[model samples]
Each structure stands twice: as structure tokens, then as C-alpha cells.
Target: MGYETAKDLTAGTCGGIAQVLVGQPFDIVKVRMQTSPSGTYSGMLDCAGGILKNEGPLAFYKASRSSGTLTPLLGIGLCVSIQFAGLEYSKRVFSSRNVASGTGDGSLTGSQFFASGVIAGLANSVVSGPVEHIRIRLQTQPDKARLYAGPWDAFKKIYRANGIAGIYKGQVATLCREASGYGVYFWTYEKLMEREMTQKGIRRDQVNPAKTALFGAASGYTLWAVIYPIDMIKSRMQTDGFSPATGQKYKSTWDCVRTIWRAEGIKAFTRGLTPTLIRSPFANGATFLGFEMAMRVLNAA
Candidate 1:
């Protein structure tokens, strides 16, 4: 396909937004499971059970519906804008270096690919921090009644409590998380699909939608598997509050890991993998499919 930066950007934005809306409830549950590792729940199934037994099925979903409505509205811009920008930026870097000439690698190196991921993540984080803050707080609120009556209430509370910064409480770590996380996610997914197509003697452009969706799901699994540990730390920093100066709260990501290891042990990092493992592939598959289709439809018009 032709690479048009504007078209790519539009598609990315729309896709990211749509994905988040459909999946934020799971997002909320995922966060709670990650952050509250030592709580009553053992795995996603257990946590889900608690929500169902005590709070009911709707309760398992909780504030997601509301948070979904608002967060993705913002998340789309962050996700799509960053992804498009990252691609263009990387393309320029490759052209300038002519890096592929001698190497004959034919695509960006792993490091270059990683760099693009960071750039995309940074872009996503700028918008995501505040929106995510609101999203998490809303989703994990003590009770349905305690949940922000609406996004407006959540916004006001954040502003009133912490000024502008409150809305984006864990922005730095968030940036790190999204940048690195998405960076790896996209690069891995693309590389994997490329390999799969080549191996199957399938034309890249002619890949079937079902297989394509499976590829997207595989990518999600790979992305999460690689980044889930860092994600665990990010969640702690975001919800529990961390001190950047002394690194007192969670400290460096390693420090956070060590502390959790001591306090909660190995099981700590993978707490919510159960539901997430179940939910993420389908969600991500839908997200990729929806995003690509949206782009096609929009471009066609």
C-alpha cells in the first residue's frame, strides 16, 4: 500500500479511539487486578468471581462504560497521532541514514524500530496520561455511587485536588509505558505478520481477514508478554503515587519490581494475566480489524 502520512494519521486516530471505547472496561478490570495484587483476588478468574458474587456481573464491568465513553475519545488522538508520526519519523530516519544499503536488512533495524515505538508511545502518553488518570480513578472507584457522576465530575475533582497536574498524575511513567509498550507492540506485530505471510506464500496485501485478526491477537499477546511487568509498575506508580525525586514510591522500575518481589513475590507481576489473556486477544483483534476497515472505508469515501 502507498504510505500517505495524513491518511495514516487519520486512520490511527480513529482506530485507537474506537478500540479503547470497546475495551476500556476490560482495561479498568485489568488495572485493578494489576494494582491490587495482594487483595482478595488471586487471579483474574478469582477477581472476576468476587466482582460477580458481591457486586454482580454488571459490577464486574463497573465504571468502564462511563470511563470508556470519555477515555477513548481522548485515547484515540494519542494512539493514532503517535503511531502515524512515529512511522513517518522512522521513514525519514531510514532515508537519511540509508541504513539499509549495506546491511541489506530491507527494513528498519530492531533499535530503529524500538525508537519509533518510543516516539509513538510518547505521543500517546501526552494525551493518555490525563485521560488515563481519569479513567483509572473512575473505573476503580470505591463503589458505583462513588464513581464520578460523570466525566465532568471526575475532571473537576482532579483539577480541584491537584491542579492541572492532578489530571495527569503519573504522566512520566505513563509516557515510558505507552512509548515502550506500543513501540514493541507495533514492531513485533508487523514483523510477525510479515514473516507469517512470507512463510505461507501469501501476498502481504492479500492476507485473509481471519488470519489477519489472529495475527493481531498474537501481536497483543506478544506485546503484553514483553511489557506486562513494566505495565505492572506503571499501574502502581499511577494509582498509588510515586516520588520521582527519591524514587521513594516505586523507585526505578527495577526497584519497583524488587519491592514487589519482596512484598508480593513473583506472582505479583502477573496478577491479572488471566482475564487479560482471555480478553486482550479478542479486543486487540477487533481493534486492529476495526481500525483497518475504518481507514479503508474513510479512504474510499
Candidate 2:
């Protein structure tokens, strides 16, 4: 209920900024692995090494043009609006006023948090589909391809090629991913935080940055580990060519999953996992910290 208010918008935007600043470099590596059709660098470190060796260290930031911050700053904030707001709405619907107020005999149940997370995750996918489509498209293309010159150009090309459908190429994958992954993410974080606060006999507002970050990191790692395969399929689907005759690598989500498995086996599902797992602790840790600090400052003012 605390996050359901208008202040979450401002805090969420700043949180997203923090997330991108810390996480984009790692994400570029992850996307490269997920979208590389040619099997381009061997693994996460190799990918980083390859970028450093051939494209220059600066090439890592080239995906989003001058700034690696653009996509996450815009995308994460917009996507999380529903997450924070819907969490509050779900709490209202499922939990009694007493439980929401933390005045009841028992604390909020795991089921309550899970229901809220599902609502939030499903909400996130609606925004995530088009946003991530533009992001992955920008990141995946080889340096030579100028088809999507920039975000606007990417939008123009997508619209011209397939109308509105083009912009949402991987909506199904996104829906599946966010619904399941984010559902666990929010539930895990909230449950962890509640346990910690209760154990220490501290109020929710008394949560330290370190504790918040720990919970956030735990939640992020757990969620990604479970749903990463879905993310790979989504990236492939998004970055695929507009033409089905020659450009389509995957006929559908399941087909993409099958093709990747046949081509690379179980390891395929974990491509770029090292960097993604490494990045999550930093990214989500900073996200929660930034959100809390921003909320405190803004609300106090």
C-alpha cells in the first residue's frame, strides 16, 4: 500500500536510472549471447573480451547509442508502474484492511504477496513487450546494419513492416516471462523483507539500505534463474527478421525453444548466465536502494 501512491512514479524513475547505470554493461553482454545467431563469443567473459578486443571497450555502450541508460530508464520505470501500483491494489483486494495496516493478529500471508506479484507481473508484460522489442533490436543487430538507426527509426521500420504487430513481436514470450518471473520476484522480496523486519522487531520504514538490497538481489537472482530461457526466446523473436521466408529463425516460441535446445542442448538455456546473474545483484540492489532513498527524500520534502 505504501508504494501505490503517486510518489512511486518519481522514485521508480530514479530507481530505473540507477538500475541501468549499474547493469547496462552486463545486459549488453547478455543480449549479445541471447541474440547471436552466429554463435559469436563463447561465453560472458569471452563476449566482454571480444568487445574489448575488436570493437573497443566503448562499443559496449554503443547498443543504446551515446548512452546505455536510455532503454532501462524509460522501459523499467514504465513497466514497474503497474508492479508497484498493482501491488497496492492487489493488497487491497486480497488482504483485509487490518492485514494491510499490519494491525491484525497475523502478518500478510505468502499467498497475498504472490497474488499481488502475479497482477504486477502481468501488468509489466503489457508495457515490456514493445519496450524490450526496441531494446533488443537495437542491441542485437551487427554494427553494419543501419536498418534501425535509432529508437525512432526502429519504431518506423517496425511499423512499416508489420504495423502495430511488428512493435510487439514477442508479446507472448514477454507475457509468459514477466508473469511468472516478476510474480516470484515481488513475492520473494516482500516475504524476505517482512521476515527480516519482523525478526529484528523493526517497522517497515526502518529497513536499512543493506537489507533492502539483499532482499532485492535475492529476488532478482531467483526470478531470472527460473525464467531465463523464456527471456532468450523473447530476445530471438524480437530480433528476428521481418520476412518469414528468409528472416524467420523461429516460427513460434516453442519452436525457438526447440531449435535452441537441439542446436546447443541444456547449456543453451544458460547462455550469458554468468553476466546476467552477476549483473542482477548490482542492478536490482541499486534499484531498490535508489527507490527507497528517492521515496524518503521526496516524501519528506
Candidate 3:
């Protein structure tokens, strides 16, 4: 790969690590709230308290230790790397195309940014779908009624039970969530950062780290707001049982949506949104901060 691609990948890895460290606790709560039966816990606090009380504090980082911290830490790290790398590459491609066509300057337009994000998100879902599936299974599994021993075990068992399709339980939902979500995610961040730089009369790299983080947080909020219902569906689909013994929950993506709408109300689409919103700011703030810092160091090097 080129130097720029390598830099983006490495920086994205840092951002992913920062995100998981800051967000895993809230993630567990969010997953539980999303996948659990109604009335599992009253709200975010109750869900968190229940996990702490019943499962211990370490329970929050459920599958990290399944095989020496490789599942989510490595999985998500790699996924984020692909996301940033794909985004930057797509942006460059679009910018070059626009310049060559004499349609605009080299700098990307807002629509270009959104399109780049959509491409990146779609690329990311290839790995993220299975990674998140494993994570959701581990997170929502009852502490006392554990299914798989760890991430690898879960993968093996699921694959053995249902083949390749089993491992990618929520692939469709993941694609939908990532496409629309990251379209908004990158567009929001770029607009916010661009406005700040314009106001300060500074270069993009000269913007304050604090402001970068705030922009990232804002992007995270907007992303989730646009895609929370899709996310809820993805979570439920990923957490659904795939074993021949246990059988499947919903037949298909449409089936899952119809089930949620019929059994629960439209309000159910917002389930677990609280913890997600709470987690987004801190997690995405750390993400952009970590990414930008790493990028600066790489550039200097």
C-alpha cells in the first residue's frame, strides 16, 4: 500500500483501540438492552447495575479475553483500520475524478464526503458483521447460562452448526446500518471541522484536538440518530440463535423487522438508544483524538 493508506490504517487502529477502551462498558449495556426480552432491566442504569452486581465488573469486557484479547480488540481494530483506509482512498479517488473532469477543485464536496463514507462503511461491514455478531452473542449470553467459551469457540460452534451463513447472521442489517450511518458520520465530521477551520482561518491540521474530538462526538451522535433503528435490528438479528438445536428466531431481515414492529411497537426501534448515545460522545471523541494524534506522529515521522 501507499504511505497515505498505511498511515490511515495505523491511525485507524489507534482510534479503534481508544473507542473500545472508552466504550465497551456502555456497549455491553447497549447490547443487552437491544437484544434482551422486554422488561429485562428498566433502563440503562439498571442494566449496567445488574451486570455489575450479577456478573462482576469484568463482565463489561465480555469477549476480549476469549483468546488473549483478540476478538474485539483486534477485530474492531482491524475493521476501523479498513474503514479509515477505505474512506481516505475513496475520497482521493473522487477528488481526482472531479479534478480530472474539471468539475471542481481537488477538495471534496459534501456529497463526495458522504459517498466516500458510504463506500467505507460498506467495505467495513464485510468484517464488522461477523465481528459484531460474535460480540453480541458473547455480550447478551446469560452469565450463568454461557454458550461458547470464547470468540474462537463461538466461531467454530456457529460455523459447525450453520456453516458460513451462521457466522454472518446480521450481514444484511450490518450493511444497511453501516451505509446510511457512515454516510452521515463522515459528512457531519467534515462539515463541522471545515466550519471550524474556516472560522479560525487555519489549516485542517491546525485545528485544536479538543475541537476535533467535539466534532467527532457530534458526528457520532448524528450517525446513531440516523441509524439507531437499523442498529437495533442488527443487534437482535446477530444475537438470535442459529443452532439447529435452538433454531432461529426470525426467518429473514424483513421477518425480523416485521416481528419487532408487530410484537413490540415502533418505540422498540429505539431500544438501547440511551446507552448508545451516552457512549458515542466519549467513544468517538477518543476515536478522532487518537486517530488525529497518531496521524500527526506518522506525518512527522
Candidate 4:
């Protein structure tokens, strides 16, 4: 189990980073679509087309890929905490209930998954808030034509300008996004597995590793499908703050959201849906597979 855990974590992290690099172009388009709902581009499909036409395929990916090394490591920790910690919490709660009735689903149910997701999301949000803030700033803005010189510069500028609070400008939005995204992600995956298990006439415990990976992937896709719009709003809210010189301002989260909605209408929220749909499942599967393997190895040791 310990071996499995280590192998998975190592493999998962490497795999995740690789995926990010390969798919970073799509990711950049997605981020642009999410952040600037009204700026340009007809839709996700068109957005990619424009990026390719103007900047070449390479232009599709922003600078975030090279700079995003910490993200996957963060992902490893997030998955382990969400899947394992959540599993433990759900098992304990369900086991207590089973003790009383002698009959209950030992596997975490959708409800339990939701609870566990919330816990994991909350924890991840805190850790990721600052990093994500800087990442978005870097990705959306250009390198030569930039605000802060680099990541370090971005941090220092925000700190000097707005203080520590500036670094965490959109923390609430980040928290809202993670909680919503992860909660839906885990809950949907567990529910899908339960359904698949019932249809196959197999116990939940009988589910295998490949199936588990697919289940995680399915859940991840479902989450992005449901929440992409809100994610667009959240990303824009977090990324649009201006430098001290420009003195530009965003009214509030709701205000930013409303402004986008008023200018762009409903379709704006779905701009990044295409690439994200492609990425979320694969990334999510890697995360779950990695964490599960890591825990297995750890337990054996």
C-alpha cells in the first residue's frame, strides 16, 4: 500500500504536470474566456481559432504552464486530503450508523462525498488562494507588457500596494469556487460509481482501480459542466484588479458578475467549457489515482 501511494503520487504529479504543459494552450484560451467574457471571441471554439490564427498554436497556451510547477504538487496534497481524509470521515460516520442498524452502505455516499469535498475544498482554497491569484494575474496579462515584473514582482507589487490583503484579493471568490467545484466533483463521482455498481450487481468495495479512475473522471467533468459559468465569474472577479497607478476598481464580486452578465449575456459563462471539460476529467482521474495509490502504499508501510 505504501509503495502504491508513493508510486501514484510520483506518477500522478509527473502526469499532471505533463498534461498541464501539453494542454496549457487550451488552458490559456479557457482562462481568457473565463476572465474576459466580453472582451472578444465568439465562443470557446472560436476563441481557440482566433488564438491559433493570430498567435499560432503555441500562443494558445499562456505563460502559466512554465510557471505552474507548484500547482500539481498542490494537487497531490489536495487529492490525498480530499479522497483519503474524506473517506475516513465518511467511513466513521457511516460505520457508527451501521453499528446501530447492522445495515448501511459502507462506501461513502453522494452526501458523504459532498461533505468530504467541502472539507477538501476549504483546505485547498486556503493554500491555493495566493498562488492562484498570482497565476491568474500572470496568465491574463502579458510578460513584456506587464504589471509586476514576474511572479515575485506580482507578489511584491500587490503586497506593497494593497498589503497582505491585496495578495488575497479575491479569497472569498476562490473559496466559493473550490467549495462548489470540489463538492460537486466528489459527490457526482461517488454517485456515478454507486449507480454503476448497482447496474453491474457488484458491491461498491468490488470496484477496481480503472473503474475508480473513470468514476473520478466522470465526476470531474460533471462538476465543470455545472459550474463553469460561476467559475468564469470567480476568475474574472479575482483577476481584474488594477495596479496602484491605474487606480482601476472592481465594485464587488456581485458587481463584477453583474457587469459581465449585462455586457455578455448567458453564453459568456460557458466560454472555457470546452477545454476545461477535456482537462478536468483527465486531471481529476490522475489526482484520484495518485492519492489512492499513495495511501495504499503508506498504509502497507
State each model's CA lDDT, in order. 0.67, 0.79, 0.88, 0.65
Q: For candidate 3, lDDT tens digit of each residue in 35-143?
A: 8888888999999998889877887876634543456788889888888998989989998999999988887899999999999899999999999998888776766
Candidates sorted by lDDT, descending order? 3, 2, 1, 4
RMSDs, each prediction?
A: 4.4, 2.7, 1.5, 4.3
Q: Candidate 1: which stretches are off by over 4 Å?
A: 1-3, 53-70, 73-81, 92-110, 144-147, 196-204, 241-259, 299-301
Number of backbone collisions per candidate, in order? 3, 0, 0, 11
Q: 1 or 2, which is superior by lDDT?
A: 2
Deviation of model 4 at 88, angstroms: 4.7
- The alpha-carbon lDDT assigned to residue 165 of candidate 2 equals 83
Residue range 77-102, candidate 4, lDDT tens digits? 44444334544454466657766776
Residue 106 displacement (Å), model 3: 0.6
Per-residue lDDT over 78-163 for candidate 2, one digit per residue giving the tens place of the 0 to 100 score = 76655666665676666675566776754567877887888878876777798889888887766665566777788887898789
Instruction: Assess every candidate by TM-score.
Output: 0.78, 0.91, 0.96, 0.76
Q: What is the lDDT of candidate 2?
A: 0.79
**Count: clashes, candidate 1:** 3
Off by over 4 Å in 2: 1-4, 66-68, 96-106
Q: Write the per-residue lDDT of candidate 1 for residues 1-301, one digit (tens) a residue.
A: 3456666677667667656655655665687798774875666667666667766666544455454354456655566655656665675676557555676544666666667766767776777677667666666666645747656688896687568866776666677678767777777766766687778887655666777677778868877887777777767766654245423466455667678889988878787777677777887776666656656676677
The TM-score of candidate 3 is 0.96
Deviation (Å) of 226 in candidate 1: 1.9
